[model samples]
Target: MIRKLALITPWPDQRTGIADYAFDLAHGLADVGIELDVFTTCTKPSRTISGVRIQDIDKFPGTFAFDQTVYQMGNCSTFHGEQLPVLFENPGIVHLHDPALHHLIAFFLYRDDTQDYYRVLRAWYGARVAERVQTFNELNNQGFWDSPHVTEVPFFDPVLEHATGCIVHSAYAQQAVHSRVPNLHIRQVRQAYRNMQPPAKYNDGEVLQLGAFGMVQQHKHVDVIIEAVKRCNAEGKRVHLHVAGALESVCKDLPDLAKSLGIENDITFHGRLSEEEFLYWMNNVDICVSLRFPTMGETSAVVSRALQLGLPTIVNNVGWYAELPSCVTKLPTEHDEMLKQLVAQLQRVSTNGEQLAQWRAQCRRYAQTTGSFEQTIQDYVRTLACFRTSAMAA
Candidate 1:
C-alpha cells in the first residue's frame, strides 16, 4: 500500500558497507516499481541512480511528501554523521544495521554537544545509566578504555522509542531489541548481496588461497587466522592468506605480528580494493575465514558476498553468524580453541577434495535460495506494506 517513499542512507561513493547495501536496495526497490527519493549526506550535487532520485540530506523538506520515510542507521560516524540528528528529529521507520548505538551517540555528543548528550541519556535511560555513561567517558578520557567487550547496555532505546517500526537483518538483533522494548514492531529481513555468477570450481594442484575481507580489526581475529596458516605451513601444506580491506588503526600491528610469526611471506594485504578488484579476489580464493568475538549483533555483508560467490566461509559461533547454515563452518568461541579448530579445518579442506566440493555446492545452493536479491527485495516490499497498513489502522 506504501507508494511514494523516502530512503535515507549513505551512497555508494562513500565506499562503506552500508553505502553499497543501500545503493543496491534502492535499485532493487525501483525495479519492483516502488517510487523512491533517495537522500544521502554526501555533499555531491543531486543526481539519479537506477531510476531513483538522489538528493543531499540537507535539502530534505521540513516535512515528507512520501507515505513514509526509512532511515538506514548504523554506528560508523563517517556515514552516519549527518543522519543522526535527522533521525532523532524526523522519526520514522528505522532499519538499524547495528544493535548498539552507543558509539554513534557518544561520538556526536562528545564531539559536538556534551550537554545535549547527557540530557538525552538521562531522559532515555534515566540517571543511573547516564551516570554509567559519564563514568565510561571519564575512563576514556584517561586513556583506559581499550577493552574489546561490547557495552551490556545498548543505547538504541531512544531511537526505538520514536520509530514507527523497525527492520533488522538478523533474529539475534530482533531478540536483543525486543528484550529492551517489549512492544515494538520489529521485522527480521535476510541481508542481500549483489547477484553474482558462481565462480568456477578450483582445480587440483593450485595453491590453497584463504581470504579475509572487510575492515581488519582485532575483534575480527585476522591475526589468529595468520597463526592457523602458520600451523598449516609448518605441517607441509601450501596455503596463503589474502586480506582485502583497510587495516583499522587498532589492527595495524597485524603485519608486524605476521612477520614475527614467520608467515609474512605467505600473506598479501590488498587494502581498500575497488569493486572489480574485490570480485576478482572472490573468484579466485579457495575459502574465506571471517571470525569475530563479541559481535555487534550485525549481519556480515562480506560473508554474504562470499556465499553469493559460492565460497565456503568460516565464522565464529556467535551472534548473527551463528544463525548461518551448517555449510558455513563455525569455530569455537575460545581463541586458542578457535585457532586449533581452524587449523584442523584447513587441513581437512586441503586434503579432502570431495568435502571441499560439497561445501562449495552447499554455498551455491544457499546463494540461489535465501541470499537471492529478488527474494530480499520482495521481503522488504512486503514488510513495508504491512508496516503501512498497521500505521493506517492505528
Candidate 2:
C-alpha cells in the first residue's frame, strides 16, 4: 500500500492543462488520505494547495522518502522543462499525458545538448536510428518544428526505459505504449472531469452558439469550425462560434482566417477565460466542437468539462475521441466530408429543438453515470499499489 508519494508536475499557477490535472489529482489523493508532496518548476517557496504541499523543483530532495514518485510527463517544454531532468536522473512512475513524445525528446537531445544526440539515439533505437536522428537534427536546425515528420517516429523509449511503471489516460494510449514496449507495467486510467453544477436549461433562441475551448491549435481544427459556422449562416441558419483559451502562436492567424471567411463579426474570441467565464459560455453554448487531428493519444480536459456540464460535443472520430459515447456527435475522418457533416449537424441541431434537447439529456446522463472523480481517484490508488508491490519485490 502506497502511503506517501511525491508528484512532479506543473502546478495550477502555470496555467497549463497538465497543471490543472496535477492539482486535481493531488486534491483527490489527499482526500483519500494519501500524503502527497508536489514539486514544480516555479521557484516559489513551499505552499499549500488543497491540503497538498507544493515546493519548487529545485527544492525537491534528490531522493524522496516516500513509497512512490510520480512524474507527470507531457510534450510541452513549458510543463516538462524542470520535470524532465528530474525524470531522467531519478526515474519513477511516469504518468504520460501524451503518447507522442518525439518533440519533447528531440528538444532534449538536439536543442539542449547536441553531444548526447547520437549516443542517446543509438542507446534507445539502436544504430539504425542514428540516421533518423541526424535527419531530425538537420530539419530541426532548418526551423521545421511543426513538420509532421518530426513526430513520425516514437521517441518515448528514452522515458519509458527509465520509468518503473507508467499510467496513461486512455485505452488507446495504453495499447499504443504496450505495442511499443510490451514488457513495461502500464495502467489505463480515465481522466477525471471537474465537478460542475447542473446548468440551467438552454433556451435555443434566434442565434445558435457553437463553442471551442482549450488552446487554439492547428490540430484542433478551429478553422474547420469557423468554416462550418460560415456555411450554416449562409444556409439561413443563425450560428456563431465562441472560442475560449489564448490562440497559440502556431495558430495566431485564426482571427485572420475567420475574417477572410467573412464570419469575424459572428465569432467571439474569449482569450484565456477565467473559470467563471469558461463555465458561463460552456453552459450557454448550444454545442461544443472539440476536434483534433494527428492526435497525441491524449484525452481532452475541455471536452471532459463540457460533458460534465451536460453540453453536447462534436468530436472528430480519431484517437481517444473515437471512444466517446454515442451521445456526443462525432465528425467523419475525411477533411471534406468532416466539414460537410459538421455543417449539416450544426444546421440540424440548430433548427430541431427536440433533437438538441435529447442530445443534451443523453450527454448529461452519460457524464453523470460514467464521469466520476471519486472513481478516478480510486483507480489511481489501485494502480499506485501495483507499483508499490513491484518495488517491494525488487
Best candidate, lDDT-wise?
1
Q: What is the lDDT of residue 167 in candidate 2?
A: 94
lDDT of 1 at 258: 88
Clash pairs of candidate 2? Answer: none
Q: Could you report the Cα RMSD, in angstroms, for every candidate shown?
A: 2.9, 2.8
lDDT (tens digit, per residue) of candidate 2 on 1-394: 8888899988765777888788778888998999889888865533356767887787778545778899998888777966777877776888999887877776766786776866876776677767766776576755223454444456787777778889998888888888878888999888875566447666567888888998888788888888998898888889989999899998899899889988899999989997678878888888889988867677898887777777899998877899888998898867899999999998898889888889888987887788488888998998988863232112
lDDT of 2 at 80: 90
User: What is candidate 2's CA lDDT for residue 252?
Assistant: 90
Q: Provide the TM-score for each candidate, comma-separated.
A: 0.90, 0.90
- Name the weakest run of 10 consecutive residues (lDDT summed) in model 1: 142-151
Candidate 1 regions exceeding 4 Å error are: 45-48, 111-119, 126-151, 200-205, 388-394
